[model samples]
Target: MLNRALRLPTRAFVQVRSPRGAFDATLGNLSAAGARLVGIPERTIIVGDWIGIHCVGQNYSAEVRWHFDDTCGLMFEEPLSEYQIMTILGSRVAL
Candidate 1:
């Protein structure tokens, strides 16, 4: 079993980059390894699709792991450091 990182609930706008182009998404929760994106349109994304997520001027490469309704889970290509996560969150709130 994989150990889950601690997730912090947040409301921030995130940019999702796919082969088609970039789309706006809502960051509902965040962690070092993954995040929950809400308000994405249904059928717009699929599992295993590689994507880039941008928030607060920070970027992360990730893969789509799961989706339900308008929400999807993304697993980062590399786990983010705690400091990086905090910086993104701090900047988000500061905006």
Candidate 2:
């Protein structure tokens, strides 16, 4: 079977907190299972680190899967439901 997860390009500011530190980052895209974070401070988040994200009135924990330059990929510990993805896409008042 094909993958059922959905991914979408997005632009939003979100908070990311890791054991190393907290950063102000831009969310490049989002999905039910993971997200791509952009513009992270160099050396703040490395691969295999656990981080927390505050986005769209919700908080999620994710693991850093990859890192390159100023961007990295995160896989959520608990995947967001489909409803949450859509809500994040449409929400403008959320920061």
Best by lDDT: 2
Clash count for candidate 2 is 0
On a 0 to 100 scale, what is the lDDT of residue 33 in model 2? 88
At residue 36, candidate 1 shows an lDDT of 92
lDDT of 1 by residue, 2-76 (tens): 877899988878888876667888888889888999988656788889988888778889899998899999899
Model 2, span 1-95: residue lDDT tens: 88756669888778899889998888889987899999999779889999999977788899999999999999999988888887777763553
Model 2: residues >4 Å from true position, as ranges? 1-4, 92-95
Poorest stretch of ten by lDDT in candidate 2: 86-95
> In terms of TM-score, which candidate is strongest?
2
Q: What is the clash count of model 1?
A: 0
